[model samples]
Target: MNIFKKNNNLFYLIYFFLYLTLITGFIFDENPAGGGKKDYLLLQVHLIETGFTNGVMHYLFDFFPNGTLQHSPIYYIIIYYLKSIFSPDIIRLIIIHIFLIIPFYFYKSLKLINIGNKYICILIPIIFFISPNFRSVALWSGREILSLLFLIISIFNFIKFQKNKNTKNIYLSFFFLILGSYISPEIGIISIVYFYKLIRLINLRFFFKLFFFNLILSLPFLYYIIFFYSDNEFNNPLLVNLYKNLSSFFSSICIVTIPFIIFKDIKKYFLFILENKKLIIFILFISFFILNSPYNYEFGGGVIYRLLNLYGFEKIIFIFGFLGFLNLIFLIKEKLYYNLFVIIIFILHTSLNLHFFQKYIDLTYLFYFIFLFDSKKINDYFNNSILVKLFLTYNLIYYIANISYRIY
Candidate 1:
């Protein structure tokens, strides 16, 4: 008991130390790294407040025609209201407060699912904070982190509904999921995964009733997208977007799965590969086709591409991408349908984007791998002291590297 207490204290200390760094970074740095969309978001909020004085309907009508508004308006609308009540600095601090609570929410969700012990669950949020993107999004205001909070809440409610079969829990899950999607449309794709789970859990009558209820709630955002959403900014060919995004997406999966690799039994992985030779062969063929395709090395292929490019070995991204596919195969073999659907939906969602960045996938995939993927596997690895140390060290190094890259 004393040992657990001591370790728990240490974890709290480390969390506060990291938390302080985020606060300090936000305060001292004129332009915190990442959140390339910050300026545009703020501008949109300003425009909404100053120009759209008539009403929300006026903003919706003028949205696509404005051309300057790149994202969904929900976040901007929230910010606009907040600005009316508080100064800009206070609004930013409010966002940071929202950002800080995410770890606690993560801990709550983990505990709800019973993925790991208290100690392991505590460590999960620390791992979340270690991600460079987490800090970046926290220190700088953006929709991603706020959207993540709502999604985590949605996941929590969904887990509760699964356990208790409570109608209220499922309703709450749908509500938060829709709320998150409005904040960031990319997150909306996750609704498909949630819908799939709902289909199996509820009867047809209840399912249809629940579906229409959420659909009614979602109508405002649907109307916005139908009338105001524009893809004029993304002029690249659809095939080009797919090729680049797939390579980056798979590479991202490989990068975030490193901690799992570090502690997992390697022989088991190889054994699965050997037993599924046909599947292995199929993955190899697809990987090779992707590798052979003409792709621009200049724009995003994710961290693997950037790191390998430094050594003039960027082509190795394909190998990591191949490994990523194998990880998905493992998920399929384990019958983790919810997780598999989340990943598939994320890929499809990102593939349509104008550019792919490591920030888009790193923290998001890490969250899935830790909290949503194979729980027994996570427990086995997370319980190891060495795995915890190595994972933290790796992320700290990543954080430093990102800062240096941005500064230079």
Candidate 2:
């Protein structure tokens, strides 16, 4: 009882309670309609109940011809085997543990970057954990969190490779990255960043050898796409999908960077905006005319789209999207090439998707902000306790609102 009086103990107590609330929410969720949790569970159950046979193999690899299998089969295959060996409850517990341990990985990555202040390093991951999407995905037993876990590990190893110039660390990074891509193909886009880094570090002969080696590993996925995949799964035309994804990408970036923009020196940001007024105006014009409002879609635009739709100010999405574009330009101007390449690759990958969800990019961008952005001004700003408090409060509100609105 006396230990609870200590500040660190109190903080841990609150964190535990918050995590407990998320678990409780998951346990009692009632498997809400349209959130996809029910489908995920049913798929797992189906996998567990069925024997591995020719039909099952075809169903998993061939995208079911009727467009039933929506995602890559690697994740389901692993889950199927795991469920065969253990109960669904055990799998859920494992997932929860995976989610719980992510912050420690974040702490290590931050430390690798020489963040120096232990408290701020700890606070950053806590802020990340408080994210509504992060919590919802974790609670829903979504595969995104698992894929993100692998991706974070990959990033950590990549950072280690950079710090120590260890060839083995780079190999480990690509290995984990490939594992992550197997779980969520979108994560494969990050390999572009890794490849870019390698180009500068390794000789051409070794670089090609490494590239082909990873390519060979990825051949199974490619074979599935070329021989077994169905085109009927995509309802939208390729051009329309690209347009919608690009708009959502910019708007989602705006939403993700709101805390950074708000907490940083406002005067400097305003001056930068002023200096780029013409470019901003051009972007807004293009956004207004070319970027269709995400609210126009019935599903999966992103948080900004939903909020704008809820308030009947859907047209203003263009402005927010433009602001996000400006933010990206500023970050690019900072000469963060690795970060820039990652964002570009992510956009290209998502451009192939028919819909864009905030969940897809929210945590990914947050990870980038925390570890890869590498801006001294932003780093200094993030170290402030006030920013952490504000970020926490914002996410708490978002979590409550997300629950109330069933915005999963």
Clashes of each: 0, 0
**What is residue 222's positional error in candidate 2, in angstroms?**
1.6
How well does model 2 score by local distance difference test? Answer: 0.69
| Cα TM-score per model | 0.85, 0.86
Worst-scoring 10-residue span by lDDT in model 2: 1-10
Measured by lDDT, the strongest candidate is 1
For model 1, what is the error of residue 58's alpha carbon versus the real structure, in angstroms, after optimal superposition? 5.6
Tens-digit lDDT track of model 1 for 244-330 = 678778877777776666555567777888998997888788897685334464756678777777798776677888998786666
Q: Where does candidate 1 clash, by residue pair?
A: none
Go through the candidates in order and give each one's C-alpha lDDT: 0.70, 0.69
